[model samples]
Structure formats: C-alpha cells, structure tokens
Target chain A: MKFVDIITTAIANSFRSKLRTGLTVIAIFIGAFTLTITSGIGTGVTSYINSQVSAIGAADVLTVSKAGDATATADDGPAPYDPDKATAISLGNGSRPGSTIQALTDADLGTIEATSGIVGVDPAVQVTPDYIEYDDSGKFELTVNAAATLTTADLAAGEQLDNESTTDQILLPTTYLDTLGFSTPESAIGETVTIGIADFAGTQQQVPATVVGVQNETILGAGAGLNQPLTDRLHAVELSGTPAGAPQSYATATARFDLDASDAEITAIKADLADQGYAAQTVADQIGSFETVINVIIGVLNAFAVIALIAAGFGIINTLLMSVQERTREIGLMKAMGMNGGRVYALFSTEAVFIGFLGSALGALVAVGVGSLVSNILATTVFENLPGLQVVQFAPSSIAIIIGVVMLIAFLAGTLPARAAARQNPIDALRYE
Target chain B: MTVPVLSAQNIGKSYGSGANRFDALKGVSVDIRAGESIAIVGKSGSGKSTLMHLLALLDDPDSGALLVEGTDAKKLKGKEVNRLRNQDFGFVFQQFFLTANASVLDNVVLPLKIAGVGPKERRARGMKALEQLELADKAKNKAMNLSGGQKQRAVIARALVNNPKVIFADEPTGNLDTTTGAVVEDILFSLNRDKGITLIIVTHDIDLAARCDRQIFIRDGLEDVTRSPEAIEKPAGAHA
Candidate 1:
C-alpha cells in the first residue's frame, strides 16, 4: 500500500474521532509547553549569571581569600581588631593584621604586568566610609563601604572624574539618581552634596562636594548600592593642603588584567603582593557566597519544571493508549492490507512527535511572555530594593534545548503504544468487535 | 482439458483439545473446475464455512493439502496469503462486509488497494467493476445508505475489483427479501455466464441451490454426492 494512503487514512481516522484527537494533542501540548517554559527560565538565569561574570571579565577567573589564624578560626566568630597592630601597620585606627593578609600594591601590579602571558594591569585604591549626604535635603544619610575612580569609558553615560582637578568634584552612578527619585541622569549631575567623614574620634565632620557626572549602573551590583552612586563613597577631597599626619584607613589596591593571563602570572602577582606586606583577594572569592545562593535557586526551579514535564508524559501515554484501543480495527485492516509493523509504528510516532513540536513551540512563546512580565513586575516591586540588577534575560539555547527535550519525550511516550498497535495479530484484530 | 480452479484433499478441522475436542470437518476432499458454479448445501454445523475459510486461505487446515490455481495454499504465509486472496479469490459474506464508512466506489477499490494497485488503476478497475454490477450510479453513495440488495451488489463489485479467478458467496442473499434475493441471484449467475468466473456458494436455500449447475449435499461434515431421488424430483417439480 502507498505510504500517502496510510498517512492520510490515519490522519482522517484521528479526525473522525475529534474529541479523542483533541485531547491527545492537548496532553502533548501541555507536556511540551511545560518543558519549554522551564527550560527557558533556566536558560535565562544561566545567561544572566554568565553576563554578570563576563562583565567582571574572564570565565577562568579563580579567586583566593585569606584563611584566618588558628585562634580566629577556633573562635569561628567576628573578632575585635588589634589596635596596637593597626597603629604599627598604619591600617586605620583599629584594624587587625594577620599572616594571610596580603595587600596588593603598585609594585605588585607592575610585576603581574611583566609576567609571562600577562597583559595590561590596572592598579586601584579603595576606601570604605559613610560620607554621603544631600545639601538639598538633610533627611537621610547613605552608608557605604569601598570606593574607586573609574574612567569615563567604563561609564554608561556622563564624563569621568578629573584626576588633576583641585576642586572637590565627583561623578554619581545612574542608580543614585533612581534612588534619589530623580527622573534622569542629567538631572543628577551638578548636584551639591555634603559628605560627613568620621574622624579618628568617631565624630562626623562635613566636606562639601559637587557632582560632575553620572555613570550607568550594572544590574548585578546595582541592588547593593556598591558601584552605583559612588559619588558619596569616593569623595573627591582637596588633597593639596591636607595634613600629613592624617591616618590611612582600611584601603584596597586592586589590579585588572587581560583575560588570557596565565595561572603562573596570577600566582606571581599574588606572591609579589605578599612580599609587599599587603593583603589581596580575587573578585571570584568575594562573590563565591553569592553564586552558591543563585545556583540553589536555579536548581529548585529546574526540579519543579521537571516534575511538570513528567506529568505531561503520563498524559501522552494515556491519550495514545486510548487512540490504540479506538483504532484497533483500523490497524487490523491496515495489517491485512499489507502495512508492515514498522510502517504502523512510524505513523503513530510521527503523530506524537508533531504534537510535541507544536506544544513546545507554544510553551516557549508563553515562557518568553511570562519571563518578561514577571521580570518587569519584580523589577518594579520586589527588585526595587536593589538598584541596578537584571534578573532575567532571553536565552535561545535554553529554548532550543527545551524544544529538543519535548520532542524526545513525546516520541518516547508514543513508542510503547505504537508498538502495541503494531504487535496486534491481524486475525484477532479482524475478529475484534 | 479445463483446469481445476481449486482442489482440497483430506481437509479436517476440530475445536478444543483432547476429550472436549469435536471435529467439524472429517477428511473432506473436493475439486472445483473453471467456469463451474457449484452449490454446497448443508445444515448448520456441517463445516461448509470452515471449508470456505480453508479454501479462501483465510485459515489453515490441519493435515491437508489445498491448492488454488495450481499454487499450494499451505505454503503461503502472512502477506502471501493476503496476496493470494486478493489475486485469485473473491469472498462475499452473508453479512455484506462492506466498509460502512466508505462510499460504494471506495468499497469496490478496497481489494485493489490491498493488492497494492496504483491509485489511478485502482479507481479505474473499481469503476469498471461497479459498472459490471450496474451499481455505477450509486458509486458515491455510502454503503450504509444502500438497501440490502444494493449493499450485496456493492460487495460483489468489491469482490470482483481485482478480477479474481473464483468468487465465493456464503449465502450472499441470506439477509435480503425474496424479491431482492432473486435480483442478487440473477447478478451472481450473470457474472458466472458473462465473465466465466467459477462460483462456489454455500446455502441452505433449496430454491437458490436449484439455479446452480451442480450441488453437493453435506451432512455431519461428510459429502453425499449420490443423487437422491427426492433431490432430483424436487428440481423437476420446481421446473414443472
């Protein structure tokens, strides 16, 4: 018999029993759709993490942090700083000095740049203080830690802070404008801000500064008020007439290098930092705790999606079994008409696969819409607490994987039923009432 | 020397096993020649249907040899049996086993489709068969919508679609009224006369059996070929 005739007949027979066919299609659709959406979300989360990691620069970045001394580890809790050691090392007022504290310095940065396979290195200085206030309204004070001066090229908008300026000027992050309820970045520029610096005696003294420009904020770091709104944290104070006896607080000197830098070069940089008696840690080590939390969230979501997909598979089995029962005589007739077992199996499997394909397509579309809506809603409400973080992104690989999985599941679900139909004895089937 | 269209030897069939086993056919043998119309008259449970099934290759008989058009029926398997049934024998059941969902034309083309004829050829042969049965006008009508006599004619057209050498009618007119049965009987006889196709019919209708060229009486799975005076006298009285 012609293959066209068999296919056409199968399709026609399926249609002849419209309710059954519709229900079967729906079962497959639900399965495929669930897979598509879940996979889409998974893809979105992974891609979001990757982009954040990429912004930090390089996939192979491995960070190391200092391990505490025996006594501190035994204590396993926060400890008071050693004032005598802090004064000896000139590490602010009451900072503790430990054997593993390896600070990075300019010399260490230079050594890293000169190492084999090393590229450009950027050395940085960091300070932590609560020195942010607004002249317009004295209602709130912004408390922050860590500060850095970045070039205008790194900013999503506005000009960079001038290194040679005698005046106390600074650039704010875009997220700061959002926090201050300013409608746009331009409006936040040139704003006067009075920063309160805590002296050694723990008294607040005010320093006036002007906002020179505004920079865009990154999503991952936006919520924590870290890099964004740096104007308050990184105060551009007049240093020409400053007292020489002023204490150097807890400071960070960071180095940026090309992604292709070898592990040997990185190790050399670390060793050089240790030789300089400065403590250093990589960015990955600092964010390790955060990544673990994000991974757990992704895993939980995937598990739920997998359960739904399994349920959908059961639905397929039920629908296909029903179809087999209804088409018993038709199948027998086909067998009698010389349709081989393989051909019959292929026909039923094809129907199942087609159902899955359509369902997955529909599901992916729904996931995209849902992801966008949920992301936007969360950004406006729950995510409002965080300043510049993006939680979701459109991911194509995830969608493709979802489609592939749905097709595979649907094909597999149809196999047993199709085989059962094929294995039926033609004589018994013909005799079946 | 006319060729024997069908030959069966020592055909026996039984149901169940051991003590409960009951033989339906006990070593029955028969030969049917080309263009010969033979009626096998039997009471119920006489094994006539079993013999038809065996001859049609729809079922295999135990400890027997059966041949149709010189090909051994015992040797054929699976699709080969289907091919033999399609290419050599046409079967008409008392129930008129036309696909109720299909139109008359589709019903006729069913056997040709089974034989793997191309669509155009299948349709052409189907239409020709319908024309032969004078059911061409009802070609597009569903078999379910037809009268009992019309349905039988449609089934006959389906049976003849592949141009088989022999046609088997197992009480083809059993479900019809006397007037409709007469019409069906006339069509069957005309096919045998005009197409020279051998016909074998199993029936309990004495009037129907009288129309055939030859009749064999079956009782308790055994054939009595001896012409009884009563059987000869009945046909003569019907003619008078």
Candidate 2:
C-alpha cells in the first residue's frame, strides 16, 4: 500500500500492545541518551583544554632547552636536570664542575627575530638562589626564589625592564606581591627590596632593587609551586650589569616569536638555533607530560562511554525483537493484504528510528540538566578555590554527532527484528495461536 | 458461456516422500463457474480443505494444472500466486482470523493495505465493505470486542474488501451457532447472487452444502460423485 498507510498501520499496531511498545521505546531512549551524554562530556573536556592552551599562547609559542648534559647542554637531548644539583655545584660541594652549555644566546634570539616568519624575539634568563630575607618581625628566613627577566608582552600589567638601563629595577608577579601583603598590582610597584647574591667564589653581595612593574604569573609557574602566592617565594629580577666571575650556573634563555608561523617555518627556526649550538622545542613538546596525562584521562572516560552505548544497543535489540514477536499476527495480516516484504520491513524500521529519535532527544535534555547540576556541584564543592571551572560546555559538532550515533544504534537495533517479521510466512503466521 | 472462474485438472497433493507418504488429494478434477455457489462437503481428514486451498491458490498441487479466469496457476511463481490470492481469491477461515488487536475497519482494510492502495482509497473501500456487512457502526471497535457473529461478518468484510472474483470459505460457519451460521450462509449466497461472484465453501454441514447450487463429496482422498445424494441428505434430527 501507500507509504503513509503502511507507516500508520505499523504505528497503530505497535500501540495495540502498550507495554511492549513502551519497553521498546525505552530501549532506544537509553541508547541515544548515553551516547549524547558521553559525547557531550568529551566536547566539554576538549573545549576546556583548548581554552587553557590558548591562554598560554600554546598555539603560537615554542620552547627550546638543553638536551643532554650533567646539568645544561646546548644540544636538544633528554636529560633530567635537577636545580638541587646546580645549587650543590654552586656551593662547591660537587666534584664535577657543572658544564656551561649555553642553549640560546642573544645571537640566537637575534637570528630567530630575523627569520622570515619571525615577528619578535625576547631572550629569557633565569637563576634560582636561596635568599635570607628579614620579615617585618626582623627574623631572617631562608626563602627559595627564582630570579628571572620577563618581557612587557608576557606581563599582564605594568611595564618591562629597560634593555639599556643600568638601574636596579625589576617586575614582581602578582603571586609574589600577594605574599608580601601587597593588596594590588599598583601597590606592589615601586616597592624597594634587597636580595643576597652569591658568586661561585662563595662571596655574597647585597643589592637593592625597586619593583618597577607587577604582573600576573602564568598558570604553569603557579601549578609548579615555584611562585606560591601565599609565600611570595619567586621574584623576577633584572641584572643591571655583567658580574665579573666564573660563568653562571643554570641559565635559562627563552625567546618569543610571531604567532602565525607554520610547522615548516618553526622547524627552520629550530634548525638555525641548533646550528648556533642551541637546543629547541615547540610549545607542545614543552607541555608533553601534561598532554599525555590529559589524553589518558579522556581516553579512559570515552571507553566507559562506549561501553554504556553498547549496552544501550543491546537493550534496543531485545526490546525490538520482543515487539516483533508480540506483533507477529498483525504483521502477517498486513503482508496478506498487499504489504510487500519491503514495506513491512520499512514500517518496523521507521518505528525503531522514531523510538531512537525520541530517546536521543530525551537523553540530550537529561544530559544538559545533569551536566549543569554536576558542574554547579563541582564548582561549589571541589573547584571552589579554582577559577574557570564553572559549567561544562559542548560544541554544536558534539550535538550533531551524539544525535547521529543514537540514530544509527536505533536503526541497527530495529533492522534484524524487522527482517524476521518480514520473512514470516503468512499462512504459518495466520495459523499461529 | 463465459470462461469458468476456476478450473482444476488431475490435482494431486501428498505429504512426506517415499514410504509412509500420505496423499491429501488424488487426481481430482473440478470446475467452478461464475455466479455459482458450490460446497465441498466431507468429514474431518477428508480432502475438502486441500481442494479449497488449491482452488484459492494458497497451496500448489502436484501433477495438476489449475487456472483461475483463464490464468494458469501452475505457471505462477510464489509471488504471483500471492498476487492471485490478493486480486482474484478471498479466504474466510473457520476461526474468523480477524486481526484481534486491530479495529474492524483496519481488519477489513487489511487486504487493500496489502494491495498498497492509498490511505484515502483504502479507508473508503474498507468502509464500503463494512457497510455491506452491516458492521459500519463497529468500524472503530477492536475485532476481539466483536461477537462471534460480528467477528465472522468482519472477516467476511475483509475477504470482500479486495473484490476478488472467487470467495473461498473453509468451514466459514464451523465456530458459529446455528443461527449465526444461517445468517453467514445467507450473506455468502446473497453475495454470489447479487454480485455474480463464485463461492466455493468447504464444510461438514450437509444442510449448509444442500443450500448451495451444487455439492461435491470427498471420501478417502477421492471425489465420490455417486455419494452426492448423501452430501445433500441431512442427518436425522440434525439442527439446521
């Protein structure tokens, strides 16, 4: 008969057995719902990671470090460098004088800035030293501090150090300022501080410096506990002039470049730095350990989601097969009247798909509600101290994929049952008790 | 003068193979004309139902040529036989065989649905068929809700929905009371008389067989035309 008549008849017949029909629909619904929730979670995680990566200029920044040396090497190789060992060497307690393989020099930064795709370059220099600071109570306390130079571009507020100036002016990150009882960035600026500097010869010199700027510290540094906001542990200090002593121990040189460089262009820049006896790494390589951890977490979550979806599919099949058995006689009557095997198959399949659609729609609604509730609970309970962990959001692509997957599962569930119904012999079916 | 609505020649049907084979029909030949009501009357296990099935094209017979309205049934494939059943033959079973879950209208329109008619036309034809059976008022009521008599009438309406040339009733009134059986018989005869349709009924009811224009008697898998008088005679004190 006409498609409309066949579909209407099939739907009408299904409802004739309300409990069976409802169960089948529920099966499809579960399948669709699980798929939507899992995919939505995946989308949320991906989006969150992407945003965090963007905040760190992950898409544009690349890092280069010394590869293989007891301490620092110019070559880009794998070596676990320990700052404690460098400190021991500086204290002359180690037999092997730490090697001074400068990875990136001013010349390397200049060369990188001159590269065709390169827009700007800044050399980063860092050294961590133990400083005894007298607090307001006049008690001398040994505090571990990282002395580094950061550019104006990297600073979230205030200004960078003057490249040609001999003045002892430096920028303090907000974390360090917070620990020092400074309420705001403006208050932290112009605060004079004294640091004890020691040379490899074991001679110490006291230097007075004024905070010319304040900046918000990067999450990487914060998460590493290097810049404890409550402890005011790390400080960014600019060297006024070169010290007359043996070569410095544990130096870090960082360079910033243009954002739009392609992979090939980045590789060329790395090669030029290597030619100058320097090691190079991309931003992704710098965060390789973090990325691995994130991937493992996402992969495990997705696997669980897949298992749930499979279970849902089984549920659908069971429901649909039961439905076919219950409606066997009705199917036979339709076939006898003029409904070809194909029409009968389509009718059953269409019902299955509709069930799937309904289930998925319900699932999506449930996911949104559950996701919102979970996110709110997480934000209020576990993530209260953390910023930017409000609600999990999914992309439109995720929505489409979830719906498509649910529909596919539903179709598969209905297919075999429909075929069984279609293959039934009319005479045998009519004779069925 | 016109072609016979159904003709069967030397039709033989057997179950199983080789030893222990049981033959349901033995080279029986019959022709049923248009506008005539005929009955095949026999006791249980006789070949009457088998002959009716062969006439309705619901089953194939070995070593026989059967034709309906000049179309060779023997040459038709499985699908073609089903098409013939759809377009040329209507069947009424003893158990009513109405789709119990569906409404009377849906049960009647079942044949038209199988024919792939559009909804509007299927409904109109189903309604017309129900009207003819005086079941129009019960159109929306489920078949199971109908009385034994009304259920049979609904089944008859379903059979007539396709307007087939031949109506095959295999013990159509077997499950009904005597009053309902007589009413069903009247409806069948009226259909044959008014619409010029062929009616072939298989029953053990001799009175029912006697009401038809002609009666065929089947005994031990063979037609016994000499026993036609016995087919006509009702049992002593038997209720009609």
Best by DockQ: 2
- Per-residue C-alpha lDDT of model 1 across residues A250-332, encoded as one tens digit per residue: 23434454566666666666676555444445565545655677667767876776776677776667777887887687676
* TM-scores for chain A over all candidates: 0.67, 0.66
Instruction: Give the per-residue lDDT digits (tens) of candidate 2, residues B53-121.
Output: 778765678868888778888777767766877877787888777777768998888777777777799
- Per-model TM-score, in order, reads 0.72, 0.75
State how far residue A368 of model 1 sits from its true place (Å): 5.7
True contacts kept of each: 0.23, 0.48
RMSD in Å for model 2: 7.1
DockQ of 2: 0.41
Q: How close to the true structure is residue A263 of candidate 2, measured as C-alpha lDDT?
A: 74
Stretches off by above 4 angstroms in model 2 are A24-28, A55-61, A68-123, A126-243, A249-280, A284-296, B16-22, B74-83, B229-240
Candidate 2 chain A worst ten-residue window by lDDT = A223-232
